[model samples]
Target: MPTPKAPVRGRFAPTPSGRLHLGNASTALLAWLQIRSAGGTMLLRMEDLDRARCKPAYSASLIEDMHWLGLDWDEGPDVGGEYGPYVQSERGAFYREAILRLQRDGWLYSCYCSRAELLLMANAPHGLEQEGNPRRCGCLYLSPEEQETRAEEKTPSLHFAMPDREIFFADGVAGARSFPSAGDFAVQRADGIIGYQLAVVVDDIAMGVTDVFRGWDLLDSTPRQLALFDALGAEPPRYAHGPLWLGEDGKRLSKRHGSVALSELREQGVASERIVGLIAWATGLIPEPEPCKPQDLIGQWTPGRIAQEAIVLPGNWMDRLR
Candidate 1:
């Protein structure tokens, strides 16, 4: 007899660097739909590790925006669950444990590369697995004494020595994908902040997340996280890279684009249902942009319906949503 599949456990981890925006809401709705359609548990995780920008006020507003949009989670920083501490900033012990294990197993090396050195290298490798942050480091070969000397000058960061093998995976939206060995990438910064690659993987493994449904912009991050999962001896989650939302300026949405900010929209008197409908229409889930609740989209959610290209919001998109 064949074994039964485990229930789907999906998650949406939002950073609190800024107010929630339309693009953020659309992604959250899609993630919620994926879990709800499959009778799975949805979880909310606060990616608030960056102390310089992420603020409690932003997180609170994000929670309020989610509530206004009719989205809820079984576990989150607000609603306690088995996963107790849902904020990444409070989960340092888990990341430190993984880093120590990686060090003991000799899978990690200390990097002392400087940004100025990176700027001088015209041939830095193309991919850093992070959008807008292309980087490559080669200090993995430094001798112990050389590293010791460098450590005396500057506190070094830990970089995972990528295993010399290709990674292959099937994405639900982007189709089959492969990546060659990327050079050493950081797992911890010199200032003791855990890197995104390490923290996200550790969180998913600990939370028992079965499916990672998020924007396609993060497609490149999978191989790096998969490698981390391999080193940590934990099973990685199934991934689906959905279409990324872009602004009228042909750039990915961010906090700077205030027109689509959810809080601004609320203050301007835009109904939550209009936002949901516009999201549904933009995602190709509905032929007409009609006002409805988040639950209305759950029953109709299908991976095939999402556009393969990035969805662009027009400069006057508010008029349509209005």
Candidate 2:
């Protein structure tokens, strides 16, 4: 008998910093369709690591919005799973442990440069070099004594020592992608909070997520995450970066783009089906806008059907909905 294939597992992780905008909702809808279509398990993880901005109320509202759109998760903060702590803030110890392992394996170094100094260095003539070029930073060569001395003046952030080589991966939607191995990035901030790159990799690995579907904006960060996966001896998940929803100004959708938030639309009495239908139409999964539920789109959902270019919303897009 043939060996049984493992079930696919996917996740929809969002930061609870603000209300869910059209961009966020569309991503969530696609992610839900992908997992549900494959008979895979879906998980919801709240990226509430940034205590300063992430509000509990925002997370609660996000859960409500997901439900209103008929998107359901097999596991999430609201519904506990084997990965008990789905929230990033509650999983700090895991990140701390990963950082310690990286340090022991000689894959990490202490960065003592203050924000002002780093910004100044970046703006210097030498900093104009291409991103793939090796970044010149004296902090990487600091002696133990010098590091100790700098530690007294300012808390040192942890930086991953990036390998100088090219990293490549085949994205489900965007096709093959390549990134130069250059900049040594931080895994921990000066404030001691764990960084997004490190935290996301650690959580995904622990949660056994086999696939990640997110916005195209994060496509550049894939190589960095892949490098971390290698250092941690974990297989990276397959990624699908869907095109972003842009406003009339040709910029990524944001609050500045007008009342695009789902909450605001809900308050305006816009039906949830209309929101789901708009997303389906915008993503090229459907030809025209018509009221539909999340489940109604599953049969037609395919990664290739998604547009490679960002969808530009019309200046009067809101008027059509109204």
Candidate 3:
């Protein structure tokens, strides 16, 4: 694979709702290379905003797992760098500001719909999938006075009043991406908390993120986030959706089956370098990286070489001792 040019920042943002799995570790390694090879900063973000689900144990285990996988970061929650509040929960005010900006710009609105209503909307003949409509809420067109009255009455949530605009962004790996937008998306949930889409866009813009490297599963999400960026009148960043790690069952790895956690491999006595090597291999960073230590891997890093498809690890991959 071709090496990435110098000085281009990228990051690994992981949610602490669970352990750092083999899939998570692998992606981190690839993102590390994507940033490090270019002499750019690799930021580690703990996406622990979901207070009900995110546990401190999971966060600690995730950090330990990343270390075990030989992945390091130049900036992160633990180290406390220039981009402090590396955890999403700490950045609520920032998200509020972005949402408020959209609100003032007539690009967002308050939605008082209940979940049952949303589900019914989804089940409506015009609704598609469990996702319902891209433009779901019926209350998005409320007048300012009506919206203010609802706000006074403690309405449910705020939603981005998606504009009728074509969305497109150049994926560093996927080349050009284009999506026809039907409508706006949610910003804050009915529970008065920010959603992933809103917070991520706000965070990226606030953190001065120029580039994003994540899994292909989120490829569709980029367009929505880009639209949110447009609603806020801000330029969006470049994106790269790297390979995913699938199970031997040919499905993307998940907790439903065992072997999901990186710590599990450590318990099985697999060397961290071997794991890193497999990630590098799976992601097409190298056809094979000999001496797979994280330091060695980083030294030989190149973002342009990373693969664009989901990489399925061999069944016996975890069994082999390094």
Best by TM-score, which number?
Answer: 2
TM-score: model 3 vs. ground truth: 0.86
Ranking by TM-score: 2, 1, 3
Number of the predicted model whose lDDT against the real structure is largest: 2
Please estimate how well model 1 matches the true structure, expressed as its whole-model Cα lDDT.
0.85
Query: Which residue pairs clash within candidate 3?
Result: 7-38, 162-184
Candidate 2 C-alpha lDDT tens digits along 185-287: 8899988999999999999888888989999899988999999999999888999998899999999888889989999999999999999999898898998
Model 2 regions more than 4 Å off = 1-6, 120-133
Better of 1 and 2 by TM-score: 2
Which regions of candidate 1 are displaced past 4 Å?
Answer: 1-6, 119-136, 254-258
Expressed as tens digits, the lDDT of each residue in 179-297 for candidate 3 is 76545567888777898998888777666667788888999898788887777767677788887888778897886556767788778777777777777777776676444776777
Candidates sorted on lDDT, descending: 2, 1, 3
Q: Would you list the C-alpha lDDT of every candidate in the order shown?
A: 0.85, 0.89, 0.75
How well is each residue in 228-271 modelled by candidate 1, as lDDT tens digits?
99999988888987788898788988755557788888888989
Give the Å shift of residue 68 in candidate 3: 2.1
Candidate 1 displacement at residue 154 in angstroms: 1.2
